[model samples]
Target chain A: MGRWEPNARERLELAALELFRERGYDGTTVAEIAERAGLTKRSFFRHFADKRELLFSGQEQLTRLIAEAIAAAPTSATPLEAITAALTALDSIFDDERRVLARERQAIIAANVELRERELLKGTVLTTAMAAALRERGDPEPVANLAAEFGGLALHLAFTRWIEPKAGEAYAKLAHQAVDELRATAAELG
Target chain B: MGRWEPNARERLELAALELFRERGYDGTTVAEIAERAGLTKRSFFRHFADKRELLFSGQEQLTRLIAEAIAAAPTSATPLEAITAALTALDSIFDDERRVLARERQAIIAANVELRERELLKGTVLTTAMAAALRERGDPEPVANLAAEFGGLALHLAFTRWIEPKAGEAYAKLAHQAVDELRATAAELG
Candidate 1:
């Protein structure tokens, strides 16, 4: 009822995820999510443009985190090293609590065509951000783009592994391992 | 009009592209497209599910072409070699005629957010197909995926270059160049 509501955004996201899981994404509604969150529809709108946006709320922040990390890598770092730094920086957000949410979110996306497409589009955007950052670091064409893609691939593989129910490795460590595996694979591409 | 028409699919696609260029994708209607193509709505429906499908009609064929090419590569071929064969196989479709259409299609997709998202989704699907094909060739987990990602990146870079107004190189040549450039870039990723 008051203008100041604590954790309104987080509450709405949790409510939406719960409703989506219980009734299916298509079966859930914005008003129902707001009601479940004990928040007003206006407050829900203030945080997310739509139900789908709730699932992807942190994309901009994640992009910024990656770009900044790549930029902040030491000048002597190779493109892959810069990418490794960016991937490691993601540990700040992929904590245990977020991992659980990620697992649920992945299942929800897997079951929905629209959400899957949106996820792919988001991945493409992140890859483009990584490439731009690499270019800014003076890595040339094709190399910058290719290295960014490798970074994107590693991030995806690491996230997938980290979200496994029984997986015990830290996200950053998994990312480093994935990048090394990809490098070895590339080396064997003769 | 007879139920059977010559070049119905191609006509519908060309008409749709022209209308989308002049009236914008959102502004153009299927009825208008059919009319412009000198056909009825029923005829248009017979050829395509909708206006968007016209631009993406060859997706299945392209997927098949790449998969079959990879599968047919020599048993001793490296993962990247198989990918190279698949890229070269694309010359069967990327002829001079398709080049013009590709340019127009790219412009239309660039101007429309929905189309751009759809394009990105298609790219992801193709990448998945490439990875699956590599896996079938006995390449390991991350290796299969990494090689496929590299192939997808090459296809994208080659396609972008091929669509440039002043580009003179053939699509297949550009594709080979892209793959080599990516390989060199990967080797330098230190």
Candidate 2:
């Protein structure tokens, strides 16, 4: 019963973020979000399990994207190399439009401890899944784990910088910079 | 009014773990833990905020230990070097007796999803604290962050192995190995 079926999900997400910003996350309701999106609560539920899911909906897709990229890396790639390649693929997932909303969403999360814990949990799961993918691709136990942790750190490093970046800055460049910093950190620590 | 007065806190910890293992964490009671430890509920509350805290009481001390170590490292140390020094300081905090209890607690946590999440949250807090300490020591923003993440990973790598370590392996040695692996992961990724 929504006017636009094709972009109902995207519209709901935008509407939800606006409401979350206008009214604190706890103060917002699904009905308000749905109404703002010109949709019904049913359509909202069909897209997201609950209000919290709006914040975390992308976690599943992001994890899958990284895992698939890791699994698809060339056979000649080293564990870190494979991971870097996988991370590079994430650069294009966000464009100019998504960046503005990402900053808003981050503010909401930073203001709430429960949301931050969920973010940490999601990060842990992403690291675990990336490690599993590397293991599946024939990496060793702890090495795979360490490499996956690096991958997670690299993505976070890049993603954070990409949040409120300069007008012309690219996400991939930030990722590469994060990768270099991680390398220097490792080398320096050693 | 119970039998044991001295080392009541220590005895309560052991007894709580024992009862948790025997009766499960959810089934065990604060009063029961107190009774098993030969102490009063007053002493139990004095030692721990709640039952879930029984397994997590060390979090505050551990965070303090790592943060103080980072803050106290030589001023000339690079961020990574400072973190290495912080990680090195952790070796003396554990003895064989504590290791046994830590393993028991980790087992209980691994068996439950909620407990696992709590453990992960504690780890996140420890990392944030370490990062904050690094920043205090004059490390630049991202450098401090990367160093803290490395520090967190190093502690995790060492602590995890120490839980089920080989008879002759040392905690500091494992920490060094983890540092080396992190370095190599970064190098390989680069």
Candidate 3:
């Protein structure tokens, strides 16, 4: 609190998102983002390494948050409950503005194959991170890993449904229902 | 039988596998594979669209085999049991020249992100196809789709474990054990 950064990063991100949505990721450049933010390219470089970096820069933070949430989950909670709590924590971070930002981010990533691959890799990283966090909580290793994998798969399924223009209600609510349906399906199969 | 065309596709597939094993996927070319098969480039194209197509050329046949297996399963059999039978059918196809081909195909795809995405998409396609097959056999749609997705996830997890360089004994056996473990884990959590 002693030093306020004046939301420079948020401003940069918003400006970049607007420009990217208007001009497309390839058509827009770091220079454009910087100019829109009333900053120099040097300042932009200090913030992000490149154009793609801006799109993915929040992933590390998100991963850290998920990890922390999982770690802080009650020991008596079942694996699924722990996971749901962690996801709920993530939902809070992704309020309306963040959801819009994420939708745009997904749009840009979806249109580009390389970006999609990077997004997949990012997902893999988050899964691995979540698994590691579960293991740290003394869960059995393979089960812990699989639990995280299921969480990831569930998230993807939920998000895919959420992004559809026809999807109604809140994303978290849809995600919770999807998880319940998935669990019911899995149990019936089992 | 008289107009068999001498199983030209199989010959070309064998030739491609040999060339890939000898020089790796990147080092091998369509022309080289054709030359090794003692066939013209046109004949190679007749058999496969490109070198990459070789990786998935048998997928259609394998899907049909899996569908047949699932269809033939007893109605009294549980969902997991039916899906296990389908996986067994898949194993028969992969186990013939499994050691080299499985590892080689995996390595080739893992090294390339686009190939991995295509592989995932192919897996999703197969899941949809299997789900449709299950529905045809009297299972409800949502349950059928979930069964297919669960089976696919288990298979992917099992294959990842089975393909480890140090993974010992028969892969089919390992896969069966992995499925059992997954069922147990799901039960425990449920």
Query: Which candidate should be chosen as best, given TM-score against the real structure?
Result: 1
Taken in order, the candidates have interface RMSDs of: 1.1, 2.9, 3.5
Q: Tens digits of per-residue lDDT for model 2 on A69-173?
A: 989998888888888877887766767778888888999999998899999999998889888999999887767877887788888888888896474578778
List of clashing residue pairs for candidate 3? none
Report every candidate's CA lDDT.
Answer: 0.91, 0.83, 0.75
Off by over 4 Å in 2: A1-8, A38-43, A184-186, B1-8, B38-47, B165-170, B180-187
Q: What's the DockQ of model 3?
A: 0.25
lDDT string, candidate 3, A1-190, tens digits: 1134466677788999899889998899898998998777877887888888888897888788879888998888777776776666667666655665778789989999778867776776677777788888877866676677667666776676666666665778866876787777776774
lDDT of 2 by residue, B1-190 (tens): 2454788878888999999999999899999999999888999998888988888988888788888888898888888777877787777776676888888999999988899999988988988887899889887766777677777888898888888845446778878888877766655443
Order of all candidates by lDDT, from best down to worst?
A: 1, 2, 3
Task: Name the lDDT value of residue A47 in candidate 1.
Answer: 88
Q: Write the per-residue lDDT of candidate 3 for residues B22-94, one digit (tens) a residue.
A: 7877899989888887777888888788988888886788689878989999998777788888877777665
lDDT of candidate 1 over B1-190, digit per residue (tens): 3556888888889999899889998999999999999889999888788888888888898899999999999989999999999989999999898998999999999988888888888888888988899899888877888888899999999999999999989999999999988888887787
lDDT of 1 by residue, A1-190 (tens): 2557989988999999899989999999999999999988998999899999999997998899999999999999999999999999999999988998999999999999889988988899999999999999999978898998899999998999999999989998999999988887777777
How does residue A141 of candidate 3 score in lDDT?
Answer: 66
- lDDT for B107 (candidate 3): 80
lDDT of 1: 0.91
